[model samples]
Target: MASPDGNHRHPETNGEAKPPAPKKQKLSTSITDSEIQSEFSHHDASVARINNGSFGSCPQSIISAQQRWQLRFLRQPDSFYFNDLKAGILESREFIRSLINADDVSEVSIVDNATTAAAVVLQQIAWGFTEGRFQKGDVAVMLHYAYGAVKKSMEAYVTRAGGRVVEVQLPFPVSSKEEIITEFRRALERGKENGQRIRLAVIDHVTSMPSVVIPVKELVKICREEDVDQVFVDAAHGIGCVDVDVKEIGADFYTSNLHKWFFSPPSVAFLYCRRSAKLSDLHHPVVSHEYGNGLAIESAWIGTRDYSAQLVVPSVLEFVNRFEGGIEGIKKRNHEQVVRMGEMLAKSWGTQLGCPPDMCSSMVMIGLPWCLGITSERDTLKLRVHLRDRFAVEVPIYYRAPKEGEVDPVTGYARISHQVYNKVEDYERFRDAINKLVGDKFTCASLSA
Candidate 1:
């Protein structure tokens, strides 16, 4: 039998199948950096990939496992679909449930990504609004910096259904966690003062553009106190970036992308719907034969698609265990390396970090030197293209227009991501590339021309 980690394991001896062995714990000591980098030799060594946060790079072993599954499907579609797919998905969910400390396997459903999960939850809530469970002008609170897709999802479903969206304007380059908590609380209270009942709150585990770790758990607790009807955590960068204990957080619904930081293939994420939430009202955005059934069954078969990524969760978990302290150790190493690299870049550019070290996870947002003339989102995009095409450096450039009462009129940042395969030289390459561009007097206008 093919094992999750691309190894072969004998499941039968003397024509009798053996019981599956329990997964072993992670090793205490991790492999060397060179050895880790060797796992992704398939990638282009010429390009410095420092944007692992956007779309994670899978290792060759996991790719082999996925290809094996694909070949198995192609060999005999009937046997693969009838006998293998459902079991494989359930097995994947079981592993993820344990990883997130979810109370039951039923609470977790595998979907393409966090966007689909958001649609599932928001559509259900929209249905609730239609049924008169919520009044017109009911508010759905979200941070001003929530993922763009998620905000669009809420606007489409909630706002169009007689509900309203209220944004909590979180301070950028924030000084402390207390500031975030205070702002969140104030948003909820201010909405209530305006006679708008805050029906829901969408919180991020980590902000994408600015790449700071949010105090989601504390925010959830505040939601409970504020009597917000429901809370959904868009933790797209959650699973491998930090220790996510879903049950401990006690949010009504939470979704995270396994592909972002969990070493899974692209387009696979898990949504956790608390058993106590309105499960009967929730349904998959794509209606399948299992529509009336629970979300786990409904989401499992969302019309014939690439199910290989979802099936390889066991293999992903196995790959994670190969490192020391498992995901915990990986996160620790990534955080330390990313912070050091971020500081290095800030010093090299004569700029500063967007937030403190503790406010970040495996990614950090470092201020780009203002001399580069990155003044707007368009400028950030142009500079990003220039960096990728000219210097073969892949990093995210973000621009934050100054909000009211801010010191700086314009702010630009480079959000750098760190993963197991990354080394100091990769970030140094980025730093040197930016320095050269600045030294060469390249500006956003020059790139545009």
Candidate 2:
């Protein structure tokens, strides 16, 4: 019942792209990877639940920490009416900062999710400025890989400001690092015409759809050379999967959600504002306490709601270390799992990797063609449902539409996650399920080889 979005491939009964090759059918009753893929099952019946959700709701290490906080919610550790919640938030930010190797934790601000982080940064840029911050035609460039919601936000921002958004047409399964770096450079150059100096280049460190890890250092350099006003990295997927030190990347602004990959509670994210950036106008997503000085966002951090999720961040870091593997060990394990899954999925479905295996970060996006054999855009919903109903798997998919003569070499892709609880079998089952849904006889000879 899932429909394709405008950005993805249109429905076609026939085209050059082909369906996957069918595999022999077998019964599946277990949670093993093979069973999940080959068997026609469902996700709802597969596992325990939390927060009325699946992945984020799992009762894990971080939840234990939240329990401790809940036992004492009324009692603030500080001497005031509240306990030491402020101190707790600081500690959480510090924990995240240390892992990412950031120089100052002060630059980090807590939020509910990655989207909030994006809104905050955009708000600061859109409203935090004096009239001098921008001239009439100044442009901001966003990527096609950005989450759809973020794209919508940018659209509204530009339309209101008399500015424009130029989407960088990126290629998937890119062959070389040079190509990625070049694409970013070209994007900035494209935004520089009409006296618009590409005022801001809001890019994704690890794009959500394909989960491609960008070379931020080089891209930042390009933006600077292009006289782009700022570089904002929406690193929603990069936080836990890879090293995300804001100082190291030198992006003017950055945001990451702890809930997605970090396994931290939902509604928790952080923003990293470069020291010199003018953040005087973070007006609080919701007007809570008055933020007078330039420290509005940071000051507003204390506004409301139970700060339990943000407070639990430190515990999540500790838990990641508790794996006995430490942070490095956790990262390696996760990265390996994703890569392993990507290889198998490509083989089973006959589709090619959407991004380089190395570019993947414990999360992968593998391409899919239209049902009619035409290279199409991504149909994440259909993939999600098929994986669950037929394979008992639960994962996200992203679709991209073909652009005019630039027919997408590959369109639909399923973005896979390999978190701590995931096993090799989980990936195997995912591949099998894809074969079942897409029906095995498929090929992408031009790209796969």
Candidate 3:
């Protein structure tokens, strides 16, 4: 099969390389609001999408590229799937490697999403434990603020393998990086005292609920000093929001969702296995023909699923690069906008920011006053529905649980996401809507009292 670069080679047979294909002409960088909006077909113009963090919005151009690949798959089926797909996917892997500054393209694999990538790594670790590579009482360290689904996956794997999960309690409205590092060190030391081997530490580059950027590099350093065997950096919200250098962070495994920040279609993400980690035993959750072929091929063709999302990555990069200041510029604007919006909302709600400004990225968690009556999960859900239904504003309201066995009051945060499509007026509208709701609720409670 001919590669995307026009080099002809067969996976089953070795052959001479052909001349590279002509590169596609670059699109003009002059993009307007209307043009950009038009490119995002999935955007609901009627509703203010302040919740880009939930599921990323893709550009229409990238969607077009995905469609083109889908059409090719539909037309050729066998030839495209067997011959052409590998080259395109390899190219995409290289793009991902460059984006995150990975040491080599071989270290990267295109997975379904960050969640799937985490599952893959956990499964491999579980296998190792069962095969006696890891002991029964080994510890898998995690933070209390990890994405709920990921935490559950880690627990399932560790428990099934007779290993225990050690959760480092991280406070909400976290004050400083040192506080987190200190807590993690305590957990590591405690594990050591108990004669348990700390095998894997799943750290988030950017946490989900509280929306704070964890000091991953510092945490990695701590893990190394404490003799933690492996580190998995869950960077689901890291890539486009903040600067991510996997090579520098030096985690054993790194996974991030390109769909969330790179403006690609959903169900697309990348996983990086550092060469020194020697985790070549890792495979997709499902075994297929490409099983044991190697990480790149094993992850690339996982059960003949649609490769449109992976194939569209190049276009997504190109489209995002054409943004006003490129990826870094886009991140800068988003961070500034969210910080401003968070400050405004926090002031309007008469509450403090969830975390310091330095810890925030494109997403900000603005504390919702306790008086707002959104203390329970049901209450938070109702508030979310109210914001969407009454104000046409789509935003996530997170209810932070009190520490285990603690009697502290539950806190609420309106985690707002800022992207190029969002405007200052959108956040102002959200602020006004929330203020009215909280004010009315407080008045009613006062009357009842």
Candidate 4:
């Protein structure tokens, strides 16, 4: 098995690092099919559960580990909170740091979720503007496909600080990577043209609604070239869903949710500040006793709350590593499954893929056929509820509005997420259910002009 440091090299036989041999499959009495099913027994068995992108399903092992931590806290509240919690928190941080290849573990702060992590950075930047560190006409750059909450956070803080939010409009059916980089450059130039300082640029590691994976490293390089002071990566779907190396990406700040892909419980995430990023005034939203005690410590103790989820980070990593050929194996399987399923559904429904396969992680966004009666956001939400309630299939249906002053109709996408517990049968059921629901009302020609 590969170590958490991501090193896969074996001993050299002839001046070349050899790869590890594949593990042989063996029948195990303990880990049975029923046991594997029991791992995800917490979910509704009847539901297709194709929405792991929204909230990942936690395994029995991780849940048990968190329960154990919660039990310890209940038994010895004082000792666990004061004596042992800090050490456990540090261990979790170290494990995550090694996983993401962060340079300094001290720079990684465990927050409630990715939104809170982003809030920390945006709030700090707002403070900088108030304290004269940033100029009056400073602007924050963001993409149109950014997570709605993070975009609102950036807009709120920037507007409050007398700064402008420069939104870079990206096409729904995205083109090449160079096109994205060019759009960002154009947005920055337009900001400068309007006398904006362009203080920060918030880019997504994996977009939420559109479900497209942006080339963050190249985007960061473009931000640097455009003289954007800080590059904050809203990597809400980053850590476990895709390959993420903070050191390699070289972003000023990166935040990801462990609950989404790390298989951890809800409200567990991390914020990584690069060592070279000069963010001195960053603090958590909740002002706890450790407010002035540095970033990690300040984020560690955010009032009296449930620390079981955060404390189980190491256990979650280990559990995922032990399950089905570990994290890399799981990711590979999910990517293959999602890509295959996406292609199959697109072909079956006579629709198109939202983005290229290479740009997809484990989530694939399939363009909805126009005949599905989804013309607005309200219709999309109604369809989502209908699928969940009537068909027992839980999936996300989002609508992307056309660009300003364009005659293009609104685009709809149904993003399907593939996890370890999911099989092809689940998506097949989804396809059949959609077909039955729409019948001959939807067809390939419905999308043709």
Candidate 5:
């Protein structure tokens, strides 16, 4: 059970997982029920608009239509005239395909969220690893910025399979694109030198902790040139956060939760495999009738559970086009807000922002004041309380631990996500709350006026 260096593993390797060591940080506001209700009010109102204004394809509606068609199914059961039912599904796929700029409908499959997508991809690797396709010396790489669940999974997998997980510790107070590129390259090069054939890698297009975007395209190119076989991207915070084009990133696979940024209903997410990769060779996370479909569309539609979430994708895409400036229009708006929040956080904390101002699209990680010395889990607990109890806000707090060259990648930091649903006042409350709690140990004051 020796984990290999540069190898990626899932967080739950043996179930005795370490709570994401979310170093101690400061929080000022509370996330009370009122706050949740407020946010939900806005979200729910948006949903109400959907039922009345327009309906692309909703579960309740789609099922009603299916029932009308399946009235025949009740009697025949064998050959129910399912022409309209199948047409609806096909139309939904086409709508999603256009929104993502995917190569074809064949490459897309809906899931619940980014985490599930990552799990499915991990299952593919695990299936291979257990079959002796990967051994002790092989390596995989992930970053401190990779979501906690994704990173933990990579670690668990690598360590359990006798492979090494090269956890790339990205530097904080990052100044420029070059700094980011340098950090990622260093990780890849270090893994290469450590006698680890970097087989797979995962990165977030837009990170949750520090809300920075990595140089994914460059990373993908480097991996392929270095002979890395696969790249899995977690876009939980990116789908509606940015205008994603799979053809542009060049990764073997990419996954995202449409519900987050796209404002889709609660559970619409998707996984995309490049046309080059054959799905028949890829294994589903849960072995189903369509496990080894080998590039077949059936795999994406497998299982018998409710597909309402998957079907809502088309309506969600339609909604985004209607209100928030549709794709490019909305993406530009998010970037603007993110920059405003980043600048404010930077000035107050007196620390350079996490990534270059323009480096990210919809998220930004700003340095904040916090306790002198704090641990990851303890820090996370505090922020969780502060945001929920005082601020009535919901956000992710993260800590990166040390590895080499850079200060312990583990630092007490917090990031604010500016989704379509967020407003300028929300960030103001966030900044004010920090000022009240951290006060001085927060540093970055010299940078502040």
Candidate 6:
């Protein structure tokens, strides 16, 4: 069933047990660009699966490894849980620790996803409110563009404790990093002026909709300067998409979804706590047998759940190394691909990029042509479905209402993501679809929005 040391091991049987199979070999140098889709062969070839940033695609080999783990668990549930699960999780944590350059292995814990991690952190802070470490009217800060789930967690946990949430209205179509820093500082200063004590600040490593890379380290410094008590970085799009060194960022808590960019299976992510973080107060959202144990132990077995995804981490690492320069090289290549495609689409549509190239990672936002008449946020849903169902293009479309002193009342954008499997023809198909839609005088009225 499960291996104590986390290596794949078949359960003993009547002289028929087998050793774990060797890892799949890396792609040959002779593999062509057209053949790259074979690596993730399970994905639909007819539709252009460009939205890799949403939920990452796993290689076939890694999928096989995970299936093997699942079979082992099914073969002997008791042995797997009592013996193999803990060590397997520990092994996964070590891999993530090295990947993100965490300060210590004890500081890293695996959660179901970024949302669960957010709940864990917010729950700790909420308990602090109960314990008098924080008082009512204390504030927790987040960005206007933070993930919806994270914002909800804050509202549920923080507000229940009589704490307040302040959303920093981060500027979209941002011109430079300075604009973001200035806006964030202004938000903190405004809170202070209102006689509020800022207890926590949540920073997005890379925003989801209208996707852009945030200057997290600089923002954390701003939090310190403002005397904010703690910093939690919600880097749902961080791990494989950007350079994430939790130690370098200097945040109290950081979380990123391996399923989003690190090519792991769904529902796998890592939460990192600084060595100086208040571990005593930090606990998983769900309390179990290991309640009083550390976050690692408490999070390890959250009661009868599939641990196969976390167990497949080593296979994921092996799959990643198959690429030319490992994760770093893969990120660089993806950045270039997405940027080039974004520019091409922008040029074709007579529009511009939402942010400068430097502000993007593997995903880039290209402004949708005004001719499409996507005038409000409500139109995004209908138009997005239209693109997917009719045009067979899968990319996220975002709509922004006009800000003060802006000319346009509405703006729409398409955020495109590039992965190893994506090719030029995928983006070309998107460009052509949008162009055709514009030529046909597509409008919000047509969408009945």
Best by TM-score: 1
At residue 173, give the lDDT of candidate 2. 62
Off by over 4 Å in 2: 1-59, 74-81, 128-132, 277-281, 293-303, 369-380, 400-410, 438-449
Question: How many backbone clashes does every candidate have?
Answer: 0, 30, 2, 0, 51, 0
TM-scores, each model vs. reference: 0.93, 0.78, 0.91, 0.89, 0.73, 0.92
Candidate 3, residues 1-449: lDDT per residue as tens digits?
54333333334321112223223335566578887767764777778788899898888777777888898889989988767677677767777888888867778899989999999889988987899988888888888889999988987887788788888888788889888899888878766777889989999999988789999999999999888989999999978988999878989999999989889898899999988646778888878878877767788777867988987776777787677667888999899988998898888777877889899989999887676655566667777877788789998888876656744343678899998888788888888887887667652222221
What is residue 219's positional error in candidate 5, in angstroms?
A: 1.0
lDDT of 2 by residue, 318-352 (tens): 44544445556667877887777777888776777
Superior candidate under lDDT, 3 versus 6: 6
TM-score of model 1 (CA atoms)? 0.93
The digit string of per-residue lDDT tens for model 6 on 1-449 reads: 43532555444232122323334346666435555567777899899988998888887777778888888789999977766677677767877888888756788889999999999889888987888987788889898999989888998999989898888888878899999888898889776776879988999999999798999999998888878888999999998899999878989999999988888988799899887745557888889988867787788888987888998887788777777777888899999989999999999988899899999999999998876777677888889889899989998889987667966433899989998888899999999998899888888668754
Model 6 residue 30 lDDT score: 42
Ordered by TM-score, highest first, the candidates read 1, 6, 3, 4, 2, 5
Off by over 4 Å in 6: 1-35, 403-410
Q: Which 10-residue span in candidate 4 carries the lowest summed lDDT?
A: 13-22
Best by lDDT: 1
The worst-scoring run of ten residues by lDDT in candidate 3 lies at 13-22
Worst 10 residues of 5 by lDDT: 48-57
Clashing pairs in 4: none
Instruction: List the candidate 1 regions with Cα displacement exceeding 4 Å.
Output: 1-22, 25-34, 403-410
What TM-score does model 2 achieve against the real structure? 0.78
Give the worst 10-residue stretch by lDDT in candidate 6. 12-21
| Model with the higher lDDT, candidate 2 or 5 | 2
**Between which residue pairs do clashes occur in model 3?**
5-21, 39-60
What order do candidates take by lDDT, descending?
1, 6, 3, 4, 2, 5
Q: Which residue pairs in model 6 clash with each other?
A: none
Over 199-278, each residue of candidate 5 has an lDDT whose tens digit, in order, gives: 78887887666667777888888788878878988877666667688888888888877666665555667788887634
Stronger candidate by lDDT (1 vs 6): 1
Off by over 4 Å in 3: 1-28, 401-410, 442-449
Assess candidate 5 and give its lDDT: 0.59
